[model samples]
Target: SEPFLPFTAQKLVELFGLEAPDWTQAGNGQLLKESSSIGQMGLLFEKIEDEVVEKQLNKLQESKKMNEAANAPAVPMKEIITYDDFAKLDMRVVTVLEAEKMPKSKKLIKLKVDTGLGHRTVLSGVAEHFEPEFLVGKQVTMLINLAPRKMMGIDSEGMILMAEDKDGKLKLLTPHEGTASGSTIS
Candidate 1:
């Protein structure tokens, strides 16, 4: 048999010992349960271990496991900072009174937060992760002392903190229990 070309559809079918789809039977929907294209691809992938030589198959399986492990979520710690630097940030708990998408901005969501400091406007780039309706009434950690900046023409007074996953999902940092609005974090 001839060597298979890398990543080719024929090679994939051969590598997996899967029956190649009969293109003529595609529209008839008789080949597989899934949509015709996906059904055939799934069947091909399913037979991979069977088609590949035992030693090479074992190596491929190991490589796949390593790749999956490499994709696991991990965040590298930031460079160490002095206590004085840490102490300078006025981090506090704040309650979200309202969240609204900023006009003309794809990523910005303007939030009305109640920090014991007062009801302040904060702009966050989390529109992709959160809906305006979902943010209301959530208590979150914020850096209340950050200098005001204009975003989407609105004055953003603080920043909300969030934990980000490797795949770019963000989870806002909220206290484990109810805390008063504007409670100091440290």
Candidate 2:
């Protein structure tokens, strides 16, 4: 009786209670899982409330989101310019007649464009953004009156208008859908 007074696994199995000792297992007086190994200390964390767990999970997700956002690309700085300098250039929407990659250059691409005025050859640093088949039919804005520049041994007649995004991706300046082949942008 004296030995059984204290509740041990053997004494509890023999105790006369409404519930059977074998039906329910109590923690073995340690914060360890029952089947713990000798060298390993297996401790059970208290069951947190569902709301608390959910909140912690959300916080981890938000922290990851912030880190990903912080690692994003930088946006280029904008410059201030006079309207007179801006208005001096003539920009027109022109259709590409032909597009082909340059012979010896990776960044340069040759483009034949119809500017309503005439068909002109324009070279662009746009080999990365455009495919020859896709570019041939796109009506895009261009600096129609730029001084000719030689690229890869070819005289480029004009420059195409392209916008650079924050991620450093170049996008062509295209008119609204159904726009004609040649139109004045100004």
Find the candidate with the highest lDDT and give its number. Answer: 1
Clash pairs for candidate 2: none
Over the stretch 74-139, how does candidate 1's per-residue lDDT look in tens digits?
Answer: 767799999999999999999999999988888999999999878999999999999999999999
lDDT of 2 by residue, 1-186 (tens): 224443443343333221343323443344344664444323323467999999999999998877776787676567987899889989888999899998887887899999988899998998887777889888989998899988767899999989886446788789877466567777
Q: Which regions of candidate 2 fall more than 4 Å away from where they truly are?
A: 1-79
Query: All candidates' TM-scores?
Result: 0.62, 0.59
Positional deviation of residue 122's Cα in model 1 after best superposition, in angstroms: 0.6
Q: What is the lDDT, from 0 to 100, of the residue 18 in candidate 2? A: 19
Measured by TM-score, the strongest candidate is 1
